[model samples]
Target chain A: MAEIHLDGVAHSYLPNPTDERDWALKPMDHVWRDGDAYALLGPSGCGKTTLLNVISGLISPSHGRVRFNGHDVTTTRTEHRNIAQVFQFPVIYDTMTVYDNLAFPLRNRGIDEATVKVRVHEVAEMLDLVVHLGKRAIGLPADAKQKISLGRGLVRSDVAAILFDEPLTVIDPHLKWQLRRKLKEIHERYRLTLIYVTHDQNEALTFADRVVVMYEGAVLQVGTPQELFETPSHRFVGYFIGSPGMNFLPCRLTASGAEVAGQAIPLGGTVLAQAAGASVLEIGVRPESIRLADGGAGLTVQVRDVEDLGARKIVTCRLGDHELKVKVSAGQAVPAERATIQFNPHLTWLYADGRLVR
Target chain B: MDKWQNNRAWFMVLPVFVVVAISAIIPLMTVVNYSVQDIFGPGQSVFVGTEWFKEVLTDRRLHEALWRQFLFSGLVLLIEIPLGVMIGLAMPKKGWTASLTLVLLALPLLIPWNVIGTIWIIFTRPDIGLFGATINTLGIRFDHTASPLDAWVTVMLMEVWHWTPLVALLAYAGLRAIPEAYFQAARIDGASAWAVFRYIQLPKMRGVLTIAVLLRFMDSFLIYAEPFVLTGGGPGNSTTFLSIHLVKIAVGQFDLGPAAAFSIIYFLIVLLFSWLFYQALLRVGTGEKR
Candidate 1:
């Protein structure tokens, strides 16, 4: 029910952080809108967990303030913040039955037993845990225990948000998609502000409406999955999001065209003008955006290998010292030894010092 | 390699068998042998069918001692377990202070058993001891040697002071093994400190607490040196626990046959209680109706 704001929030575990390297989370401002399914996506050591803890009020940020609906709550305790968090592993009360575990948060708030019973049963039914309501939680299989951890949060009607810290890491591989779809259904039904943290790109792309990509303790971009795929605002985002990722080549911008790794590629005048004066320039094209030409229609290249992946194929080509990949459709006939790669002009982009140029 | 497959591996185990027999089995069998016989001298004994067991089972003195033994062990467990867990909870989680506190707690447990008794005698003697002098200075006539209640109190104090550290050490280890995520989840669930202890910390600690309970129970049940040296079963046999009474029978009266019978009964009683305690502790929250 709350829209959270992180205003210049940063954290460092050291009491005396003399340099930027000591900061676990660099300062940034963000707003997680109410009722949105957001994913904080990054690899390990990217400070996503630190940021999640800040929003949950587990750790007070060393810098800047946190606000809910524009009210500063930087000093609030976790329980008082009206938030719930599920850890990476299941955290169940070993002595309590599943029903009691689900009822814990509501009972702690002094809810009446009748209401607690209703909410616990409803959540158990939603989680497909009704059959286990009478069983002790500790000895249950990991997936069921994890459901209890999440159920405790769902039972609290007044919680502002429920955060998940890689809650599906321990689930069986086949069960992961089922549980993920269940979470999406729950989000749609209740419209809770759900912020999930994960390092897997597929999970982040599917579960969240907005994927906040981070790297090296810094958030690189925040966008929808389509926007991230079509227009990556940072080079790292372009490299990290796709299956084969984006291919980059050192290039020189000119008045009429660009020279890419000792080969000339013609560009529109306006496109060349925008990247006219960059000290460091590179052309980025997605594997899906590049086409293979057998008669050398575009930039000439040496074919390295072609790997078929069911419906489509990935063509690995070499341009001077640079290796480039092109995703060809099922109908395209590629040469065995040599093929020219022509980047689709609209999908190609210019990057200066790892940042996307418009 | 297949020149001959001899049974030399069996010979390797013979040495261990001999060691085990000499250390444990032989002495145990000797006690069992004496429990059912009337020994007059070396190689001159008569088989006495279940005579000594029947006599020892009905002895009034032994009955009183058995009751006292149960009371002592019950009080020991009732006092030490919670006290030790609290101490474990209060201990620092990390850094130099945690190690320092651990070393301080272990200091009492490291003292020799008889030395602990001698130390308590010096500590509780009515005239020259600081504790006794403090009571006398307060206008109270208190002497452990003369009063049965005072002797029991002093003996209980010495036992608790000496062995509570073992329980605390085990509890501390259990607490440390719990992952930090459980505490975080508890806080997020709005659980109070007491609820966290009841639901999370206590449940997580049951494994170690079971061991602690059994160890303290059996040790306190078989207690001999500390109370024996401090009170000498004194003040009209008020502090005569099972072991002290058994010693009085076997050594004081030199009635080894009945003493051996009494020892076997004592051993069985301890084993039964320990087994029952373990089963009850482990079954706290197991299954529910389908």
Candidate 2:
């Protein structure tokens, strides 16, 4: 296993990328520590897969160096890079048995027959594919085929990293959890550096030790799941990580405090100072951090709609032209028309130009 | 379920039945009638009750012709399939070169059968043709009209030249239909070039290869215009195939009864071989399940 580092890496599919729109991945520097499980999460076409391909050595970056354990490998081909990648679609050798499919990478490297057999059987057992060892891979269902693909990646012992590009996309919903748990177990047992690329937030939050959020071909924030949820460095991360996302309201920063729609909202002195000189000012708060105030002492909101979600209900309200969502527990009474909502002092965050202010 | 149903559906199928009867069944019945009868004239014929079939089956010339036909078709399939697949694999995958190569390979397939035979005949003439003259100048006395070996080689060459492109085009289409992910996965698996072709390319090409085999088999088995025009069953019947011999009997010598009997046997042989080929092709896929 090796730590992978991208130094000022950028990629573009175009022969000549003169404009920002031509680049598939913008210039960025990131490092994946050895034996770490990291998820590169983003929406579609956000360069998550492009970053994965660059890491796998499938595509060389147009403008930077890729180093593995401090060794420059930017020009290295995929085969010599000793990395295993599982694609979105299940790719299996149709003519081979499941056993042979798992044994292929090892056999390709001239591993001895006995060792190849042992490794294949070991990986097959780990992937719960022991019963299917003798069956042709083409006859299996999508999930089983995907398991075989994963087993192929795990069969090789000398791989530097195992990269997954949406490997669980074709799996059934119930089976996805089981497969994800199995992946975690394998990661712990093998201690292999794993980088999973996906557009799913839950998969990233649950599977990764650190999640890298990307937007519009650029890295937005890289942090642990709890850290990203609690204090997102960028507004996109705040909006993307949580259900119903974080709400942003236009505001102005004054010497006293931050004011939204001419109503003063409580903020720390330092946060207000950080936002003082910003051309764009806004306040972000998660829906769960906002509660209906019992007394009329907070910002007044006109309740537009309420969606009951069993344990908690989402209250969508309007304060002038700005829309806000507040999460209220099932036991709380929701006002029919108007209510005053208060933001938790510690949970509320201030943003100046979409960047978190302190 | 109701005991009685509308009979109007039968009318919907009448047109298809009429088309089939006129196109296939009627012609087949005529062949059967001719096979069982001793026809002296169009209207004056006597029922011979398998006499002609027994005579045709026992004929030594028919046996020789059948053997020659099998040898020619076997050689054609053996040479064409691998050669076609290799050419397809070597072809460029994209851009202007790929289109140019495809157009060039498809040229032979567009030529008419009789025209291909005529072109090869002039192109292989010993005195004037480039190929025959070149070989002759290289100290090889090549004369397809006189030497049986030369005639066989010429016919095989002509067959390969005219039809190998068809198999190549089909194989190319199959190769193109395979997704890019398979190749990427193979590369990541560290598979060698030969291993990639053996495990991925060949298995994926099975469907189109089956079609190529069946088409080449049927077309080569029924080959008439090309060889007939080039050789005319020449060199003392050394290159006479089944269809050529059958034609000589039915039309050249006007022995309609024996020729008709032989035609049925020929048809049955082709049908049996084609069925066997199809079964073998299908088994390659599903047999591993057991």
Candidate 3:
């Protein structure tokens, strides 16, 4: 296990990072603790995979250092950094047998044949690939080959960390759950430093201990799933972390209350102190946090549509002219034509520009 | 749009079949007819049961030619396969450099086969040609016109120059087909350079390598033009490969009966060897051959 420190690391495919637009991965500082499971979570082209490659030593940062176990290894080769990576697709050797594929790294390290055999069998068993030890990898199905790739990464016990770059994206949906659980189990047993990169929120939240949320090549926030859901640092994080996402209603803050669509919603004593003197403010609320208010005390909305998601119903309602979505239990009753929904001020957040308002 | 009808797909292949029959089947039938009879002139012929086959099978010249053909094919395959793969790996992966290298490599493959023979013949003349003059000035006593070893060397070098790019192009296509994910995985696994090449690159290249080997083998086994022009069956027939010997029998010496029979035997040998290579490759490609 090793702690990885990214000290102002930035990367660019072209030399000199020509301008602000030239950077593929924006400069940032982060430290991933040893033996901690972390996920680089963001949408595609958000530089999550780029960060993983940088950590694996595949691409050197255009600026700053990557220190592992307190050793500066920014320019070191990938092999010397001791990282194991599982690609989005299976990358096992097709001509070699499953056993040979697993044994390849160990053999390359000049380990004894008996030790290689033992370690190969150990990883094969962990991955449930023991039965396929003699079968050539080329004939295996995609999922099985992916497992062999996983096993190859796991076979070496002395690695600094194991990085997975959306390894479950190529896997079938039905099988993805099992692989995630298996990975979790391996991390628990071995206590290896594991970093998983994915755009899927559930995969990231469920697999990693702490999730590093990124957007447009910059790390937004590093926190647990609950923290991200409860309090997002950036507007993009609030919008990206949930299904049916968070809704941002245009509003202005006053010394006493908040103004929304010409209606001054009283900030109620508790929310007033929080909303005091914010220059540019937008009210943010999760769909599930908005509840239907009885007797028409809250903002009136037109019921645009209702989607029955079996587990939960999504209520798509229009607040003034902006569409707002709210989640409720499946088969929940709704008022016909128009209704009023009260926003839970405690769960809702206020953001100024793109950042959270203090 | 309507769903695709799988049953009518056979109609798409009719034109191809007709073209192949006209080009291949008709000529093959003519060769078979010639194999079974003796031609006295362009029109006169006599039916000869298995006499021509017997003559070809017992001939000492046919045996020596077959041996020479095997040696040439073996040497050519040995030189081209590894050289081409290395060149393919070393070529730039992207941008203008890759296109420039591809165009340069493709130049040799574009030249006509007969032109290659003629060009080599002129380029290696003992007195005036640069290659021959350079070797003679170095006091190497190199003369393809009079020396069997020199003749063999010249033919082998010419064949290598002409066909190595074909293998490299195929191998390059295979290498490019590999996704960046595989290399990422190799890096994460802490795999050394040799291990990555031996396991990932070699296995991925197996399909292309199979095709390259079969093509080199068939072309080298039936080699005719370049060596024929440079040495003309050699000063003592030392560089006389099977195709050159067969051409001499049917055209120069006009031993039509025996030559026809010998041509069939030669074709069968090539067909059989290629079939063996194909079978081995199919097995390995399918992960069932090994």
Candidate 2: list runs displaced more than 4 Å.
A269-279, A293-295, B2-15, B285-290
Candidate 1 per-residue lDDT over residues A1-358, each given as its tens digit: 8999999999998999989889989999999999999999988999999999999888899999999888898999999998889999999998888989998999888999999999999999999999999988887998898989999988888888989999999999998999999999999999999999999999999999999999887889999999888888888899989999998898887666778877777777776667767788888899999878887478888899989987899989999889999998877888998777778888888787777775
- Residue A122 in model 2: shift from native, Å? 1.9
lDDT of 3: 0.86
**What stretches of model 1 exceed 4 Å from their correct place?**
A256-258, A266-280, A329-334, B1-22, B287-290
For model 3, the superposed segments whose C-alpha errors exceed 4 Å read A266-280, B1-14, B284-290
Model 1 agreement with the true structure over B1-290: per-residue lDDT tens digits: 74355576768899999999999899988899999999888889999979999999999999999999999999999999999999999999999999998999999988999999999999888888888788878998888989998998899889889988899999999999999899899989999999999998898999999999999999999999999899999988999999999999999998999999998999899999999999888887555322
Per TM-score, the best of the predicted structures is: 2
Interface RMSD, one decimal, each candidate: 1.0, 1.3, 2.0
Model 1: TM-score, first chain: 0.96
Lowest lDDT sum, 10 consecutive residues, model 3 chain B, at B1-10
Query: Sort by DockQ, best first: what order?
Result: 1, 2, 3
C-alpha positional error of residue B247 in candidate 3 after TM-score superposition, expressed in Å: 2.0
Q: Clash pairs of candidate 2?
A: none
Best by lDDT: 2
**Candidate 3 local lDDT, A1-358, one digit each (tens):** 7999999999888876667777878989999999999988999998988899899988888888999989999989887788888888888777788998899878777889999999999998899999999998978888898899888878888888989989888888999999899999999999999999999999999998999999888999999999899888888999999998889888876666677776665555565666566566787889989886434678888888888999998888888778889888885687766888888877877777667654
Give fnat for candidates 1, 2 and onward, in order: 0.87, 0.79, 0.81
Query: TM-score for every candidate vs. truth?
Result: 0.94, 0.96, 0.94
